[model samples]
Target: MDPTHADLERFCAELKAMWEACGPPVLTSVEKYGGPKKSQVSTILNGDITTVPDIDNVAAILKACLANARAKGLEPPANAEFDYWKGRLGSLTRARSNHSEPGPAGNPWRDLAGTHPVWESTTDREFFRPRVVKAAAHLFDRRRRAATVLAGDDWLDETLAQRMTDRMGDLLTGRLASPAIRFGGVEASLIVLAPLLHQVRVAESAAALIGVRPIELRPSASAGPLRSDYERFLAGSEQSRLVARTELTGVPGRTGAKNEIGWWLFHQWVMRRQDPVPTATAPHDLPIAEEPLRTVLAGTLDRLVKLFHLSPDGLRNKERRNLVHKVSHPSITPALQDVRELLVGLLLVTAHKLAVELTALPSTIVEHLGIPNPVDLGRLRALLTGMTWQPLEVIGIGLYAQCHHEAVLEALLAHVRQTDAVLGSVRDVATDRVHLEPLLRLPPRASADFVTPAPHPDNHTRPAFVVPVTRFRIDETRVRELLMGEQLYSDRSLAIRELYQNALDACRYKQARHRYRAALEDT
Candidate 1:
């Protein structure tokens, strides 16, 4: 082996034994004048949960590994990107650019690579390995999976150590029939401590155990993944909100709107499933529609078909068109089309499966109500005006009260104005709107990040609420609630100010260019 590579290899093996300390920081000797004199990955993380890594213990080990690798005449990674054991690490680099008619070289990572050299604390969610959790209990649940510390002041007696090893087996592995193996103290401890113990077990397995007391455990010092953003993302708390902001800035394609086309594409890219198979089949009685909307599915689908090129699948303008497209339907009224297609498209596309589920229900619910269709209601009322048998009046009132028909709602609102019992109609209609109903928003939902109610598409809900997809705009307020928080207004992803800036810049650029050409002609 090459001596450099061999030394690095040896250093990597030896550094694993030294759990804690700055012995592994590769660039530590390079020396900085301000801020953190020595910057590694975890130290850069501070306390943000979103940026922690899955295996934090590897910080020191990775540091040592990098140093040894670099000392052996290997190059520093061109910034943070590298591949190890088929796994890739996201890297950010800072370096000086080439000579460009100047004495001073500029930082290449900042100037050319479009990144800042000074590392900042990250905010990312973390995912824990459930298997590691299971394995911790697997190894330690016996005899409460106790750790035996040496009692002696120094290294303790070797014979005592050997005997202690036997005692550990007896404690953990011995068959205990007496006292029914009372788990009084440790049972609750297990519930609270099981997860922590598992982390410890995982640490121990890597030959990177951090010491633990009976009640407390500290994180192991081993290797620095050196990418706090990614690490914290994996190690952060699970209690994070459904809507989260990441340290990552800028939209993927163009101007970095949170709603930017590029960001939207990236969202879609991450949610795409390479495999076509589903985890389970849908329900037989799946209600694809909600109340008044369920009552109007066919009528609505009829109007939208030519506009959407609608078949079974939802909207079909183009896959990547903006949510509220400027294109107008030739046949429909523009205002209705705007609300029906734009707002409704936003609503349905967001909760499309719910819309589909709402619309999927049979149109016969209108007929089942024993009332004439809105198309025929005027004539029906005229015929019923002079008729006898007041019982029909009772049936009519009951049906009107139950149905979510807009005409019914309008009539009832009128009736309520005349006499307030009709407010019951509005309240009943609005209150009962939330009853669980299946509506097919999308057959195979293309985006995992699309906002919808919880309890999953695979799961079922109750009696059809038959809600309009537009009614679902109530949920967008929730998105607004997340975005308009005190700390989040400045987030570029959520900010609208940049959009104003883009418009202003375009106007200024055009005016300035015109003036520059005019000056050139005069000269």
Candidate 2:
């Protein structure tokens, strides 16, 4: 007896259930009873094949299961089970035979329309509404299925699940367009229409969000189609003038000369122009009252006194004398006292120079003078007191701004010359010592105490010294000619195309080789 589709489906279901319940023995073990391989077994159980399995194969599977059960020390099913399956198979065969009877010929019109008789009788609205509703329901079901597959074994909390649902709703309602919906539109339509609708919804939502109002298709006149003659004249005049200027100034017999001409015109008309008033030198003198000057001087003196106790005895001390000498004669020795004194003397000199140059001493210089670390207040005061006469004279000259103060100028010049002479001597000594230090160091001994030993001569036969054989000298010019010569192809373009083709072929060959190698490894 043959089995019907329902009988095959039921039997497959029952067989799958039994296989699942028994710990699902491997296909290899089941094959001993003439059962198919695992893939064939899966196809049969899944009812994926058009035809049903033979009764003999079905019986073989039952026997295999019984064998497996007994081997596992489990009780085998009674003969009743076999009887039941046999009866079911027989019934299915009878039903299939009865159902196989030829039916009325199918109507070609109905077949062409792909509709049933009931559908043909109903109105369009009645037929479509249920389909639309069913399609919508199916779309939602598909989304749920997709979400489930994506979720896998992950425990999605309520909040996350709610968010996902909301996002899906947004996608469906055209509020959010996702890439999946856009690119997978056609594919998703076959499954369900939600994805395509999602993309449309998203686009609509975006357009709405952006407040893109629909514009009239017809062209509208701007500003009542009026033209400003003055503006037109100005624009035309400027364009003509630009063209004339380019033609007039452009270099003769040169390509791209207009750009150069424009640049030249710009430089002459704008960049080369000068301002009437000079900006470099501005008068900085502020006409303040004599009282402000006195006040500033008095404050400066008081701070200096407090900063460095400026007593007459402290000025004439041995430490102050040594400080003056250190400033006059800079040394290479890292003596902390000498460095501190020298820095203090230089600070005082710089302050005097600033007082002469600037109308008011800058606060920054004053701050530096206030620091009393290695050089204490007393030492700074002593150094300042020693130079007090020179600064006063220099200040007077600077303030009077008269050319007849040559005496004072000469004295200052003489002092600078002396300082320069001392610096020159120090520089010469440093240069000579730095340049000669390595050369002056004691040389290494050449005798037994330091000399390197030489290798002893061997008494064995010496290997013959062989000169290298030169086969060829590369002709670089010829090589370049071979690569670049027009003779290689009918034209330069063809040559380039040929080179490109060779490169492409090489790349393809390499890719194929790599792919083959990878396939071999996989196998």
Candidate 3:
């Protein structure tokens, strides 16, 4: 697939090796087994092709080779062999067209995708998944309620709070909803809560975000399975995007606003940022509907709050305070149970929101963002219709919990307990006033006890035997022999040939890096 045909030749050579390993079946026999025509098979097996072969032909040849391998009583490749080769085929296909425009064929957006800013809308059902919309609604609900709570609790200016909270209530719970909420309130609420909300750290938040090792959650534990799950999700997201990319980009006239709207939905809904919609590097500003955007976000928050079992609005000030209360405070340590639940819920909403946003974008853009395609939009509607989003019970727990929530929750609970114990122990005996000085001033005492052995009157000698665990160690001389000796190569000239091949491969790899800036940046 490479422009120089090096990769294509390498692929053919590998196929030839596979064919030879399978007793070097005749071209006719391979063709009989549903492979390409005899002449084409011969050319392919000869490893002299200049162009990338058709995928169907490659698949057929692989099948025939696999069949021959099986007939010779040899061990067949793993079940994923087909998939592995299929991926290689896809890579080759992309490499073949590396110089082509990005995005779907015949689309002008393909040319403009990277040069111009993208547009997105959170309210667009076509763009956002239902659950994401639902999640956004919930977030909106919380922000408004939080604003109202701050107002009633005298945290904000009374008049401003009143304007924000007015008519934003549900009749049943005496709370507010999206339709009644004002744009001023939405913006104000976001600014006001940004500080507190930003400070609220869930132990697994970083792990969830980066698929990195659990940093805040675990003090000493390894990242464990978290990284792999996140990696898998990312891989799957990319795969899904690739599968659906052509269709998405093929949507006619997809130059400016739609792309921006999709990205905005992703950033605001999935990433949960309140920044204004992005502008193009071009001089002109894109016309974005501000009031509608604010309305959609407000709605999603309200829905999410209800999902969290909180009132939409009204005098839920105490409950709101507890929701955002700092987790480290000893007085409110037990309140972390609810906090964990809320955090988990937020994660769920974000996950669904992310899934929706990615599914709506073109493959190139999705690849650029490295976002997850968690659900197939086509099937998601039918699948999620009967389902209710529950954070504590079920939903995203299988993958999200292992990678993010589960360990962090346990660690958080343990941390709370430990803090409570330390604080409890430092209480003054006479004055009964809690003293904080000892905690900072004194060194930590050992949690476990140690004792010295009593003297042995007989003075008898005792020996301890420990079992040895052996590991393979490479000898320096042997490594040198392996590298330079005739053990590996009968002809010394073969070594020079391999080195030259490796040099060429390195050049090809560098060229590939130059072709895909996004992938290069990620690495």
Candidate 2 per-residue lDDT, tens place, 1-523, comes to 1224554676578777766555455656667787777677778667776565667666666766666766676654322134335544554453343334322221111121122212222233342333323333432333333323222111111112112223223223331132222211111111122222222222222222121111111123431211222123223432233334334324443232343223222222221123321221111111222343223322222222221222223333445424322221122112211212322222232222212211011212222221221111122222212222111221111111111112222223333333333323222322444322211111111111111111111212431122234535465446766788865666889988988999999999999999999999999
| Residue-level lDDT for 499 in candidate 2 | 86
TM-score for each predicted model, relative to the true structure? 0.15, 0.19, 0.27
Q: Candidate 2 at 429: error in angstroms?
A: 99
The lDDT for every candidate, in the order shown, is 0.25, 0.32, 0.34
- lDDT comparing candidate 1 with the true structure: 0.25
Cα-based lDDT at residue 386, candidate 3: 16
Q: Considering lDDT, which of the candidate structures 2 and 3 is the better prediction for this target?
A: 3
The sequence of per-residue lDDT tens digits that candidate 1 reaches over residues 1-523 is 2222222333233333331232344444323211223444334333222222333333434445445555565543311111221021111000001111222132121121111110011111011122222322333322111212211111101111112222222222222223332221111112212222222222222121112211111123543442222223324332022112221234342221222222222222222224321211111111322332222322332232222212232232334322332233232212221122332232222221111111112222121122222212211222112111111222221112222233333333332232222222222222333210111111111211111221211123631123254532244445656666535665756467866889999999999999999999999
Higher-scoring candidate on TM-score, 1 or 2: 2
Q: What's model 1's TM-score? A: 0.15
Clashes of each: 52, 3, 33
What is the lDDT, from 0 to 100, of the residue 228 in candidate 1? 25
TM-score of 3: 0.27
Clashes of 2: 3
Comparison by lDDT, 1 against 2, better one: 2
